[model samples]
Target: KKVEEQNFLIRKRVLEYDDVMNQQREIVYEYRDRILEGDDMSGTAREQLGNVVDRIAKDYLEDDFPENWDLHGLYNQLEQMYPIGIDLEELDIESVNRETLIHDLREDIVEAYGDREEELGSELMRALERFILLQIVDERWREHLQNMDYLREGIHLRGFAQIDPLVAYKNDGFEMFTELMNSIWEEFARFIYVVEVETEDHNGAGPTQPAWGSSSNTSSTAAFSYAGGTAADQPSALAAARAGGVPEEIQGAADYAYDEVEAPAHVETRVVDDKERVGRNDPCWCGSGKKFKKCHGA
Candidate 1:
């Protein structure tokens, strides 16, 4: 009975050790890969991805000290150790005291290259890798958004599908996200071909970021300015009326035959004592040289 019990315990230990070993191998591969070719990632996202990795590792390794794993905290440390963008006021990778963050991660990979700490190591590696991928993806996305000035103003793509603008943006944001992920992978592959080791914050903190800049890479853009614009061709009222107008349609011209009426021929004709007055009796000086009774006065 005692011999059988001992054998059962040994078998259980062996299985546990095997699980640990498999996890450690995964951690090593992932860590080394990121150290060689990782880009940059944000803090919050790193924490979240780290949690995912931790959960996956726990499922496989089934460790007893699950509570000891705080990947979010570890990621914060990493960010403080290796920030991204430059700011005159902010600390940069160039000003850091450590050699390289990748070095530290590599050392961690070497030291933890076993099943015993496989779960924790896996979390660390995943967290680091995801952060790197995230940066590339984010840079690409920001560039896309900034370039698409139309989208910056916004689009009602959903409205084309008979949906609301907000709904459309939300729906298309997923498509955008998928494309961003693809861009990240493609960029990662490209970077891996020639990228080399570089210094980052030894404190493991990510960098303070910068504001998004607009890109001039777009093919079509309507550069807008509020300052007095280029003058546009505008039509005069007469031209507009001649082309298409309410008054033109409402009032047609009158063709009155005014051959005998005096008032109709001229307005306010002078009746002063002049040497040659425009007399009606004197052959009607309106050039209708007829007798006064037969002409305008009559």
Candidate 2:
């Protein structure tokens, strides 16, 4: 029930953004047509149109962009179109955020106007939906990051069983990642299945629902292996454990043994705090009284 309300809120916010994007698009088209016919847009029209163009750039940046992109080619062309006034150079047009934002638009809009969301339509709606999904995906990604980092650096716990320390750490890390995967799966399912679009808004007419379960492309359930490949390629924690990899927490714990990473004999490693130092040393002085060895050791 609470999730439903939250979903509604998310959709409401998305719709508002879509509305803004559409307005910007309408204005851009109006002015673009005038310019094509060799007519000058009045100062008022130019200013309004400029505002719209700015939004196109802004909304695209805030939407579904991939990492690492280049915008130089588009900049040159935009400069030619709006030269002497349009000033198409707004924010980092090539940023991942920008590309994602642009990419989020409908395929038609993308093919029609390229990076410019200056004329909104289905593309604008697509952006709003993607923005919401991306927000959720980001949270999931952060959780995955935690598990990956954990798996990549397991401790040498094999001393107890007289096993190879590296092997022990790997196995431990694999287990940890499996547990993390279960947690991630539960959360992902909850968000996707239980969460409903909000119906009542705090100030506005809450989010309008899509035609019930309309989003076919929304899913975030994949095992991730740290230090192997990208997160998506990872085997779920369960899979890793079955395959004999270490647990995630243990793997992450391994790095604790060498964290202050001694500087080269010449490069003075700054004296980090007691806790930071405990990141590797003996027992930490904290009243928990657990030896740093037992508490946070590799």
Candidate 3:
């Protein structure tokens, strides 16, 4: 009888753990179904864009005084996400407050988005939005499920800390789910602004291309160059965005194209003295727009 009771307890514990994932699965599936139904996601996209901008603002504009704000950092950060037209260097700093900064950023992003929609037309743009959103949600949810399995395997260890293992698992799971949803929004917003549709037949003779492809040697790093970028393209900001920061899904998206370039054989090599070497915290010598520690130093 005692052995049978122990078996029952084990099964009950397993069911309780699975219930957490069950709730999450329901939420994710319902979201996926809505997308599959071909709902107009422009409003959702705008809301997410606002959220991304507000998140950046909160990070760099939290201070009240203009002197206390990091406008350069803010500009660099924004470059990683969208190709906004606002020139921070051109802004009148003394007249600018947090509200002014937010308004300008939002206005530029909205304008850029409008231009993209006009270029692509409403039907095509809507189709692209739905396709991208659904792809991201499905991929992220699959990854989340794997993560939940890993979490469940170790959650029982919390009992050693004199805590209820099941309670700890539930709390941590909730936090992870929240992060997953936020990441979906961030990635979708970033991709929409930069991705472009291209075809193999530039002369318009062959059938339109169904997708884009990228290839690089294992030793070479991949970088995405937006097709419609303006004079605001910052090589430094692009380097920072590509510096091990982007999600794999974005890096390997269907619309992205990259190339591998080998260094010239005739170039001379120079060894710098230790004192002249870039500090780990200093800017990288490669002009990748990231600190040495985060770039080559890493």
lDDT of 1 by residue, 1-298 (tens): 9999999988985574345335434543453344334323223333433333333334432333333343344445433322312221233434333223333443432232232124333333333234334445446655655533344245545567777654454445546545554454444323221222222342476642111112232211111111110111111222222333233223333212233443454557767754256464577655666865577667
Model 1 ranges with Cα > 4 A deviation: 1-138, 147-149, 152-154, 157-161, 196-298
Residue 112 in model 1: lDDT: 28
Ranking by lDDT: 3, 2, 1
What are the C-alpha RMSDs, in order, of all predicted structures? 30.3, 29.6, 23.3
lDDT (0 to 1) per candidate: 0.38, 0.40, 0.70
Count of clashing pairs, candidate 1:
19
Candidate 2 to truth, TM: 0.22
**C-alpha TM-scores of all predictions:** 0.22, 0.22, 0.63
Winning candidate number (TM-score): 3
Error of 2 at 70 (Å): 57
Alpha-carbon RMSD, candidate 2: 29.6
Whose lDDT is greatest here?
3
Tell me the lDDT of candidate 2.
0.40
